[model samples]
Target: MKEIIAIIVFCLALIKGEINSEILIVSENNCHQVFDKDQGQITSLGYPTFSSSNSSCTYVIKAKKGQVISLQWKDFNLPAGHDRLCHGSSDSVVVYDGRQIGINNLYTPMCGNHSFDITSSGNMMTVVLSSTSDEFDIMSFYRGFKAAYKSMSHHCKNMIYKTGYGAIASPHFPMAYPANLDCVYTIKLNQDRVMLLEFAEFALKPVKGNNNKMAMDDCDDYVEVYEGAISQRNRYFRHCGYYKPHPITTGGNIVHIKLHSAKSQLALYTGFRAFYYSGVPNKCGLFYGTPSGALTIPVIPQTSGINVECQFTIKSPQVAYYRVRWLSFGQDLFKKGCDENNYIEIYNGFYDKKDKLLAKKCDTKLDEFDTQYNEMLVRFKIEKFNPSRNFKFIYIGVTNNTVKVITDKNQTCTAKTTIVYRYSGPEVISREVKCELFSIGGLPFWASLLIVCGAGGGGLGAISVAFCLIRRRIRARRRYRRFERSDSEGSL
Candidate 1:
């Protein structure tokens, strides 16, 4: 009699297409494997044409640090709930944000046929699919799902870059930035390398004061630069305005930049575009035998801080004179006077209050001067905020025998040649041109050279000369347009 009852129950299960040989446990080996180095895929236990039975499967995805996991579903088909009692029918998928499964970290419980994506905030994610035997129906035999998971780096906020020479911008830059946005970027470079930051474009909502005049002292939306890793104590500068600030350089291997926007401002915000790279650090103080060296504010445009001072004292051999040449000089100019704000001052001797002041300059004009004494002191001071203000100069120890001055052709106009002469050796010539100048209308410089060379049958030297001329002409036209824009803006 018992055997007859068992056979009848087995027949009913067969008719319902329910496989009830204990729950189907898809172990880690049975489930799809997701390696940390590669993306992976997951599907229903019997996928494509899965059976309706009591079964459970779990898929785990992992990634290395500084990476996050993202899951995208291509197809999802399961029983749908008609009411609260059958929210996801008996078949459902539960996603957890991390490795450990807990009710608090449940991302979502999904069912039915739909496509969606979910990204984990950390390096791990867990997905579990379960079906109950009580709800098994022959019609649900086609229920199945498909998903893919991959590793990706964080964007928009709290980013870290290990390599060099990349861009960092306000989130959704070149568009109206989001309101109440806060982001931080930490740049790490090789040992002994420093950071160089240049702004290609910048625009932020200006704060207005009395009479609707633009206020410079206060800012509601601002970007802060730090010398080392980001910290409250390491704050370098805070900037906010329509005026584009100058390029900046860090003194160490790490640079942290923070961007913030206020809640009130929502539109007409064309954020900012900035590039960063690793470069050599600045040198200061006395030198023994290094023949020729350059010194400048480690950071350009001097936008990092206020009430800042940088001084360098150069001492040559007793018989040699310290010669200084300004490669490029720029500073904040006050209509009233030069000394009211940022300026560079040269002292005849080791920097002293009693020493003679050779010159007090605060403009872009180029200048060359030498110190009367064997020791020379150069000082740069910034008493207030100034955008895009900086100075670069080169110095060498010269005696009566090594007094020859080699003129730089690029000094008068933007040329591509640099001539250097050593006191003990022959002259060294170096030609350098901006890489952008070589490309004309998206064509490589070599291609243009080849076309011109092939058409004219000119020598290699002539081909080189022709290429330079063409590049120079194109650069001149670009400079003309830029000058015109500058003039128009000045008039406004």
Candidate 2:
């Protein structure tokens, strides 16, 4: 009879839509849950209008990695205190910014009726409601809060890379980066190889308040590069504009790239795409022991940057002179001279600017240049707002007493050969001789002609003509020998 009476009382409590005070734990059916989907909704336990003392309910929201959760509250009606402040209220709803439940993770606490929205910086969020010993009127019911949550995947932050070659883009990349967005990427390579960073495309926010200019020092959006690690002192270059940036080589194996966007800029720009790879050391230094070599700008399809400079010094043996021959050359040239814009300058000594100026060339022309001293310096400089340019040249060490002979053996009756003689001493003299009429096995030309005519059966008439030609050739050869003997005696 007692058990039947208890069952009837429990049925009566359910009919009244009341929660048992002893049932303090929240079950899976009573709590709201969400996962990787787009949206979800949650309400208080026994929602739509009910009050419970000593009851607990929880709501869990989740999203994908690298995404955040956004929540919007529709209705909030907790029992208010007499002072109208929810700082120390007994009946309240607490929001945890992350999945952990702790005092430090609490985002906010609400007690009275209010509607607001908030966003979590992580992939998960938790909302908890607890009504301890009912402090308000027991006869009246209080409606709790209801909220809707959605996943947002637009936030950009930290990224890491560990490979030989990789690419990085802005927050939205092909699209415009979000306003007030700061993104950073760290790239690491093997210890023996250096890092090379090249920009395939770059279109940042242009400078404002200047009609004639397309770039400036003050930029609304910019990208910065660092050499070893990310720090203020290790910054290598900072750039902005629509022009593509030239390739940058770091000193060590690590590189850090940082991108910053201002809040005011709203125009859509395709930001930038940068590529990085491992490379050998490419910088200004002294080169020796290399007999013949070629030097040029390492990166292709390069663009404009601020006050960039590259220098190289070529040193030869003590007794030899340096000769530089250009295979290909092209750059932005000024009408008057190469003092402005992008240019390459050559000096005659070990130091670049401190030495004597040999010549400066920026136009599209192939030329040869020789240095007076044994060492030579070549420097290339680029200013703001310039097109891409490059040059290729070969350098060789030449001695004064060197003789080079070149011969072609493909001709049937005659062979052409060139001989170049370089004289030593203070006053240098060089000359080239071209010899084309020389017979094989020291045979006279007229004799060879006679043999060929005899073999072809041209009769004695050819023999008579060959005999006369042979006598004349013998006389000519004697005269040439006498002249050579006289010349040799005069030189001695």
Q: What CA root-mean-square deviation does each model show from the true structure?
A: 26.6, 28.5
Tens-place lDDT per residue, model 1, 185-258, is 77777754665565656777667742123443477787776656465434545666664544454445677778
List the global CA lDDT of all models: 0.60, 0.61
TM-score, predicted candidate 1 vs. hidden true structure: 0.31
Candidate 1, residue 165: how far the Cα is off, in Å: 0.6
Considering every candidate listed, which one attains the maximal TM-score?
A: 1
Which residue pairs of candidate 2 clash? none
